[model samples]
Target: MNSLFHDRVRGLNQAPLRPHAQYVLYWSQMNRRVSGNHALAHAISLANSLKLPLLVYEALTCTYRQANRRLHTFILEGVPETAKRLAALGAGYVFYLRARKSDSNNTLYRLAENAAALITDDYPTFIAAQHNSSVPAKLSIPYLAVDSSCVIPMNRFEKREYAAYTIRPKVHRLLPEYLKPWDMPVLRQRWNLPLPAFHTEVTAGNIDALVASCEIDHSVAPSLTFRGGALEAEKRLAVFLDRNLRRYSTDRNHPAAHATSNLSPYLHFGMISALDVALAVERHGLENNLSSAEFLEEMIVRRELAFNFARYAGRQTECLSSLPDWARRTLLAHATDERKPCYSREQFERALTHDDIWNATQKELLLRGKMHGYYRMYWGKKIIEWSPTCQDALETMIYLHDKYALDGRDPNTYTGILWCFGLHDRPWGERSIFGQIRFMSYDGMKRKTDSAAYLREIAWLESTGCEPHPLQ
Candidate 1:
């Protein structure tokens, strides 16, 4: 058999194997599902080459910064389902470790004990990358980090890309080779290694079960409307492909239309892979359609561009200070303009103050765990205008996004917030409250879109009582 091992860097690379090793270990992090998983395929191939079984271990540690209820619940939902899927494929074992001081240590030691070679998911911005980088140094076994998240592995673009237009062609050139569907490897032989008797200190519970037990911040609760899991992701994708995709080109900008794919939360949680979604869209044979192309552009090109930025850009969380010099200069020049009315971060978060449309957008983000793309841009730009300083605007924007949006704290969120400061955007004629940074206003939104329709949609969500944050 051809050697199953291949060198791939998603966010980080897998470690070189030692001479004496046992079974292959997959330390699950970002990529959670069994289906259409490149990292899982790589690990399976390594195990086959080594003539050993494969073990998948996931640790739900609470120590990581911003380990909130929303993130925890989304991750927990996939564990048991993944465990069952692994068993069906005749993989060695699936272990889920919940957050507990004793359990966290025990799970780490257990993986180190059984693992001959370790493979983990590569994520750049969040705690996952920190763990992947730190854990390998402590272990005697070799660790490999696989790049499974992006359509094109992030390292392929050595530097931060300028825009989607620049990176789109580059990714298209490589897609023919990398975009082929991954086939599940048939496990030819089963090793009869004795199952370890060490008890899993972490409890294997559902999202609700785990959330109730967590000591993390509950101020921002799970959205009743948005539930995370592979099954739910697949259903949402199907609905989008079948319905919204046809009008996506023309209607995606209109928040009231419900024409865009709502699969972002699923994508953020790693419940569904981009390749899986792409293949389904291709199978639909809608490529000739303009709307289909537009949808794919957002999914494959724009979304991956966000990933490319987070991967290559240092200090992903730092605001306009980290942007390119041209962007920074333009923003600072316009920073001191007088505003008609400025709102505080507290007013924004509570969905208070004026502009019913903006307030509606905030409420939607809070209740639905998402905001319409059109409103999202307007939402961020308004923050730049309203805050006392551009820096404060950036900080407040990141805070609200990370706190409420399901797809918040993602590369897209980072890039989207930076967009207000002119990153990936050209300088405009200088103006107060915005200077040369691209400006988006409530009035401009009204001129460009059906404002009443958008407002009505928000009213409908309010009537349904879908609250994103807890009552203050």
Candidate 2:
């Protein structure tokens, strides 16, 4: 059950290889990077064993829900680097950009025409989940969905965990065996085959034009702060270790301190692997006498807990039924207890609520495509407080994330939203609109952190049309 080599591989379809195929096909779905990638390594190994060149196929289609300029640009930003890395590793890279609904949707099927085996990323949510379930049966070659997303492969968990505490001991115990560094396997054969007809070469100067050519919604703009891709991800991580790791424990909960690693978007996109990040942080922490235990816990234990839940729950990941019996009961009991103020989804979206702090958080989400982690809890809690119902609040949160957040639609995103409804959480003292669910107060946030500073920072960004700390 080794995370890197054994348990990471999951056989989906019972199919034989294509006879006299030209090359092995590797589909980059979620774990999009070339290094610290167990799936890519597996693809290379199979290709080497079969004495065939490897062809890596990656695609971006404008057909998914809420397809917009922001999402398209971010994904396109990673393509140039991916092409460079795959070429350096002696693998042929084919990038298919399906720009419209009319564009041929059969790129994968077309690429698989002469492939020996089909290998793709094993992911729990979004389009990857749908593809893994549906595409395997259609292919004539062996289909594999490798678990390259987790530091410890999600298959290591036998059952859904109740909470972080229950999974913490088990995860820590397995950490030593799986936590070491992994280098991508070298390939014996170089890809020399002509690229497929559908391939589109991505370049830095043409990303905007390429995204503009897509049929996705053009209204939503790219993030004002974060850039996408492996190089950008690596750069941000080095910056975090050099400056912010020491302050992570003490000031992580404060929004304006900038004391935390702003690596969630890269982590979400798989541009940076958790295994790589953890190893670097641990080395830096030891050398500097700074404790990285807290950061590691969030990165490993809590993050994987989300994966475990998503892997086990299936389609119920977004449904409220995924909540525990206690949570459902508590939320149901207080469903009708609201009376003071109820706002529509539009109000929440516009940041029209009475609370300045909550509005600031939403503005951050709107302008930067992500919000600070600490205030994000406040943002969710306030939605539950102001919206017409808990379900409404849930829908609003999911909608905003799906549309705007760089890290939205992830397992952690859904799990964190559900945490506001008391999922994976214990019952707390009863209140009017919240029942036994744990409640966060405005006074509590104001007391523990300097809200004024955060408000000022966001105000500056909103006025200037940029983040206080833009990557540029």
Task: Summarize candidate 2's per-residue lDDT along 1-472 as a digit string, tens digits.
Answer: 2335888899999999887899999999998899898889999988888899999999999988799998888888998999999989999999999998999999899889999999999999888999999999998889999988898889889999999999999999999988998777788899988987889989999998999899988988888888899999999998889889999999999888888788888888889888999999999999999999999999999999999999998899998899999888988988888556788888888899889999999999988899999899999998998888888889999999999999988989999999888878899998888888889999999999999999999999899997677562
Q: In model 1, state the lDDT of residue 4.
A: 23
Question: Which pairs of residues have clashing backbones in candidate 1?
Answer: 10-147, 13-145, 14-144, 14-145, 15-143, 15-144, 366-468, 367-468
What are the lDDT figures for the candidates, one per model? 0.73, 0.90
What's the residue-level lDDT of 252 in candidate 2? 91
Each candidate: how many clashes? 8, 0
Candidate 2 global lDDT? 0.90
lDDT of 1 by residue, 1-472 (tens): 2222243533233445656666788877777788877778888877888877787766666665566787677667666677677778877665554555454455666756757778788777676757776777777666778777777677677777888779989888877766667676866446456556542323354457667676677777777567677877888888877777777878888877778778888787678998888878766745645345677788888888888888777575455666877888776776677765788889989988677888888888877778889888888887777788888888898788777777877788888888778877787887776767787777789888887987876776678765332210
- Candidate closest to the true structure, highest lDDT: 2
TM-score of 2: 0.98
lDDT of 1 at 304: 82
lDDT of residue 184 for candidate 1:
68
